[model samples]
Target: MIWIIIEFLFPALLIALPLTLYKSNRPLMTKFYLRMTASGSARKLYARCMLILILLYHYVYAGGHFGEWGILASTTFCAILFSFRRADRWLTRLHEERKIFFLTAVLVLTTCAVPHLHTVAVTLAFLLLAAMFYPSRNVLSKWTDEENRIRWMNNPKIVSEYYY
Candidate 1:
């Protein structure tokens, strides 16, 4: 059933994207989290609290992104989190260029609380594309000057050379 595609399967694949992409580095992520926590700074503690709230929202909905209420709540949480990260001078330009697509995806996910297969697929597809797009996102883009941007653009494309 197309319902199956838009229901559990799409979300399952969404879960899988981070699983696969972060597979090699989950231990490192844990380690980094631990290391950051040890400092016990107020900001860090607040961030941890927000992370917990995000989890609470996830749990409260039985982790259902397809339900309307869940989508609104989850998208709110995500937008808050993304704003905090992407507002940094270091994170700004990296997101500003493609902001339309990113915001569109967020809007799609936010409205997807009902089980319309076509709509859900579009939402899921946006998420899938975003998941794949993010890991390769240029973190250093904000630090570059126009000359650097041009110089970097001038080089012939090399996919294999670019990715580890």
Candidate 2:
């Protein structure tokens, strides 16, 4: 339980920071992410953290059959694909690009299909991480106004939400 929460810190902070601080780097960072992604942002600091965490879970934690491990392993790709193409993009893109999902499913299914499932499971876990990652922005962008203010916080006051 504690590990789950601890592992969630980066993802949570990525969402919470802007929402609480009401900062919108949409314009600049849109270009920045493109540049970064082009320059290999998919393998950046946070992405590495998530990958390492997944590897830790599989090698140090699950260390066994694919079923118990692959589902959790694939979530990184699920999240990347989910964010890159909005979850709404599922119908449009999933059928075409969902090979990653199927690959995860297959590796997980191979528990009964293969021997020494742990090695295959770990291999698939790392392969799953290689697909891609895209962080969702604008969890707070919609709340920012023309003056770059958090319109919801009337009086232009800095409230306790800042520390949140």
Candidate 3:
């Protein structure tokens, strides 16, 4: 029970950090996250801590063919991916690209929450999701110029909800 509470509370606390510290702007949140993790060592430390915490949780709660190894592998792969500039660009894009990445990441997390899915399926989904971000860096760099910014700002639908 304590572990479960910690598991829930830890993420909530982390989420609350940026929300409380920043305005309700999506771009600000992205920038805040990037700044917080600007250091490669800091990022690695965070990933290592997450890996330890998650593995401990899985070992205690998920018994018998629950695919703990697959989960670990996916986490490891994601940590490795985070080391690349491409991953950072994909994650921190200041435009619609970031929204797409955010949506895809949320979807992946949602799907990964299904306890009934085989571990292998979950692992494959995670890998595919990670791979999906690979091409966006180049594409977004090309699209993030001032002309595109002007076009994006001119959109009526986007102007009202300008935070995202």
Question: Largest TM-score belongs to which candidate?
Answer: 3
Question: What CA RMSD would you report for each candidate?
Answer: 15.5, 11.7, 8.6
**Each model's C-alpha lDDT?**
0.40, 0.40, 0.43
Residue 110 shift from truth in candidate 1, angstroms: 2.2
Cα RMSD for candidate 3?
8.6
Local accuracy of candidate 3 as per-residue lDDT tens digits, 1-164? 76567545534543465456433345554443333323455434544444454444344435434545455644465456445454444434523365665665565577557654323234333333333322233334433566645554454233223333
Alpha carbon deviation, residue 41, candidate 1 (Å): 50
Residue 113, candidate 1: alpha-carbon lDDT = 49
Tens-place lDDT digits, model 1, residues 51-111:
4544443443333444554455444544654443432322223324467546655666665
Better of 2 and 3 by TM-score: 3
> Once superposed on the true structure, which residue ranges of model 2 sit more than 4 Å away at CA?
1-42, 62-96, 112-115, 122-164
Q: Across residues 46-160, which tens digit of lDDT does each residue of candidate 2 receive?
A: 4455456554544443423335544453455535533432432432232236685586757656752654344345434343333323322231232343443434234223222
Q: Give residue 75's lDDT in candidate 3 (0 to 100).
A: 49
In model 3, the runs with Cα more than 4 Å from the true position are: 24-70, 82-84, 94-99, 116-164
For each predicted model, how many residue pairs clash, with residues at least 3 apart or on different chains?
A: 3, 0, 0
Pairs that collide in candidate 3 are none
> How well does candidate 1 match the true structure, expressed as C-alpha RMSD?
15.5
